[model samples]
Target: MNGMTDAIALALAAVLMAGAPLVLATLGETLTEKAGIINLSLDGSILLAAMAAFAVSATFDSPWLGVAAGMAVGAAMAGALGVIGIYLGQSQLAVGFILTLLARDLAYFLGHGFSRQPGPDLGVWTIPGLGEVALIGPVFGPIFGSRSPVVHLSLAAIFLCWWWMYRTEGGIRLRAVGESPRAAFGRGIRVRLVRLCYCLAGGALVGMAGAAYSLAVKPGWGRPQGCEGAGWIVLAIVIFGGWHPVRAALGAFFFAALQVSGIYLQDIFPSIPAPVFQVAPFPMMILTLLAANLGRAGRVQDMIRRHPFLKRLSQGWSIDPPAALGQDFDPRKGL
Candidate 1:
């Protein structure tokens, strides 16, 4: 019985740890895409944040400070994307993909030298008295009957994103801008500024999420092990969430569960190809995109009809991205 309790605790921790990165990045992506600007650069943004956070934490010898530095870099990266898409009028998807390449290489170069260096790992903080229990050890216990601090933070973020995306006046205007930029502009919303702000804010959160990967999830920073494919999983989560914060959060949990379970399964079945879990989110992404397409089949089919190659593909699956995903909205287009 005691052994079973311990196993369950370890499994729970593993699950939460695996899902932590996804939760952070996907939640942030949900907010950004909700604004109609898909950040293809989150791959890069997260990498940059990981390196910067690790380096800064090492330099300052403070995990908290390091987390802050990481978030700043992430936000800065998103701001760059905003400048290109909002001011320079480049392709959002293209530019984002380009930056992902840039971010990866940059992180590689910078992180190479620091691979073996030591940095502080974030320890779990629990309540005082409750941490002392018979069956519950320090790593797993009643501890005032709660989970890791990051879990609480993630929950708070879910509500915050929901409020900002739905309840607030600003959120309404943001949705308006995303659905139809020209209409949003006509309604006296400063479309460019609003979008830019959303991009930067989203980027900042992504950076923190990436930092969480190293600072919390992985706990120790190394080049290969940190921020591995997390950015894309986050993108899938946004699509899975239908650009809603709460739903996207659930998507994060689902992906996270698969991830933790995948890791656990390794002990039980080492022969199973690791790539299966690594690649699981992508297929799930396709499914979500198809589902969203089903919601807007008319427009999706029309677009597919316009594209010779896509028309055949559309017959098999739903094909919508989001209400306004990935399209460069020009006021002149009047959409």
Candidate 2:
């Protein structure tokens, strides 16, 4: 029983560690989207930021500095995208796609020297009293303790973002900018400025996630880091989570479960190819997104409405992207 408990506790800890980056990325994207922008360059942004973080940390011998540098890189990339899309009225998707490719290549080029180099590692701080508990201790210890502060930070961010988005007046205004820019403008809100600010802030978080990968989670830079496709996964998670911060964090954990399960299965079934399990999460994520969207289907919604409890569940699954998401707002036109 003790062994089983240990195994379960360790597994949960690993999942939290793995899911931490996804949580940050998903939340960042959610923030961007909530501001009526889509930073499709997330993949590139994460890679470049990771590379920058690794390089900076290696130079400064400080993980925190690396994290900050990474955030700056991410914010700059996002700011450029926001500027072009919001100010110039270019297609955000096209610009974002182009930037992704560029960013990826740049990371590969500039990070060539930093590849496989050791950098400062984030120390795990385990809480003394809580970490000493029997079963729950091991589980929550790492979360609150010193194993990786990123987990705690990620958890804190989810709650903070949730409250800011749902409970505050500023949050309501932010939502209005995304959901109805024209209405927001009519209400004396500065749509473009708000969108730009949130987009940059979101990008900063995404960048921090990139740093979390190198300095904390994986700890070191690789020529082509294994985290290449994580950005896309995070995008799927946002949809799976219905663009809500808490749900998105849960989705991150869900993916982490699938990821850890794949690894565990590989160990259990030695005959199976590792890549088979490694790629399993992608398809599973798609299925999850499809399931999450089921409530949006007319027939399914009708069925849900027939039952009160079912309707509540359906509502939970329903996805309502900001009304003006991806739409340009021109202050000159008062839109």
Candidate 3:
């Protein structure tokens, strides 16, 4: 029993560490979408940012500088999307898709020289006293006592975003811009500017996520970088979370749990091909999404209606995206 408990604790710790980047990316997308912009270039952006981060860290021997470089690349890509898609009236989806391809190729081409290079990495920190607590020490120590700063940042981002979105005036304005740009304009909100600001901010966070991969989580860069498909998963998480920061963070942790489970499955079933377990989480996550959406079906609705507790529990899972998501807003046209 004790051994099982220790294993579970260790797995939970791994989940927290592994989920950090996902949480950051998901929160970033959630903020961007809430402000009525879509950054479809996330996949390529992450790859490009990861490459840039590692290259800079190797050159300067400073992980912090690499983080800055990565953030700049992410913000630049997002800014381009905002300028071309939101301001110039181009299709957001088209612009984002093109950027993704461009960024991916750019990363591969420019990063060839830095492939498999050594780089500076962030150090881990552990909180004092927490690990020494009685009874719960063994369980809670790894879960909360020890972690990379980036992991702690991801945790902070979840609550900060939630509080901002639900508690503050700025968040209200931001949401207003997303819900109805024309209405927001009527109320003296600079809709385009607000959207653009959030785009850059969100992109910066996404870039930080890339840095986290190179400097802390994955700890290196190469042709595959091991984080290629993460951006797409981040996008899926944003949708699955209904563009809410807290829910999106939860979605990230859930996916992380699936990934950790995959590793355990591999150990348990050595006969199965490793690739099979590796890819299982992606499909399982999609299926979970399908199941969540089933709440909208008539039968499911009827069942929920009959059970007050179930209805309450289902509320968070059933939500719609922002009204102005992926739509361009022109201030010249009045509400």
Candidate 4:
């Protein structure tokens, strides 16, 4: 490959690798939201899971075991949130936020000894026949390669989630619960139970995202960790993606591209402050959120739709959060 082509190829590969974690986390959050629950503790969940995955893998010398441990931790944390916030009638947002802080500290403290230590990782795997293809091999090969099977897993997750949320009978019920729990309840669906189930399941996926970071993307754990605020960014990608699994995956890829862009730019502009590139995605995402939500009002949306340029720019930018999202439900009370 030519220099430019190679640079582009590597950049895209980096995107798939970096975005894998966000893809998992975004999908997890999307599933929870689809069931009318918000897993705000995702930020901490990722941190704790990463620590658990790395620490356990280092100790046991088994990456798969570490992944299992990470998923268990994530599921347990999310289950606690469901039982307390959903069943006990506490604020899910408050509980989730507190959990993030606590998990962050716990990961740091408990994982102190494991920092900077080497651990098991999914090394690269080139396809037997396909890896020989001149063009396709280099681009698609790395995604499914053993170095990071999470890329393939993330794609599978997106497909499965999209199918589950739209193509099946159970999916319709899931949406009904989020859109209108009362309506779902009237149809004999257990709203609270569905929400709790999805919440726990979503947390498990988020936990796996953490393991993907340690075992596949970054390898091991240490200070100055880049995984700390990734959960928040993943959450933003969910909103930026309009809560659709596929769109959210695209958003994750886009965000990862931006991160890669910062690195690419550093080579051309070495004088620029490094932190500027690091933090650029944040404001960009905030602006994207503004663009999306600003057109939600009736008149504004209608006006934007009528103008060619404005309509084009505002395409797919509107707010449609689940109808009964975050609202406590009582099946016996009829709402």
Using Cα atoms with residue i matched to residue i, what is each candidate's TM-score against the true structure? 0.81, 0.96, 0.96, 0.93
User: Which runs of model 1 end up more than 4 angstroms from their true locations?
Assistant: 1-9, 128-148, 271-322, 329-335
What's the candidate order when arranged by decreasing lDDT? 3, 2, 4, 1
RMSD of each: 6.6, 1.5, 1.3, 2.1
Model 3 residue pairs with clashes:
none
Q: Give the alpha carbon lDDT tens digit for every residue of 195-250 in model 2.
A: 99999999999999999888888888886587898988988898788788999899
Give me the candidate number with maximum lDDT.
3
Clashing pairs in 1: 293-320
Clash counts for the predictions, in order = 1, 8, 0, 3
lDDT of 1 by residue, 1-335 (tens): 86776677777666665666667777777767767888999988888888888888888889888788888988888898889987888988888999999998898788777687878856676556554656555545632245555665676788888887778998897787778777778887887888888888888889988788778877666658556777887887776676777777777877777666666666777787887766675676667656755745587667878898877664444323456665666666564
Alpha-carbon lDDT, every model: 0.75, 0.89, 0.90, 0.86
Two-way TM-score contest, 1 vs 4, winner: 4
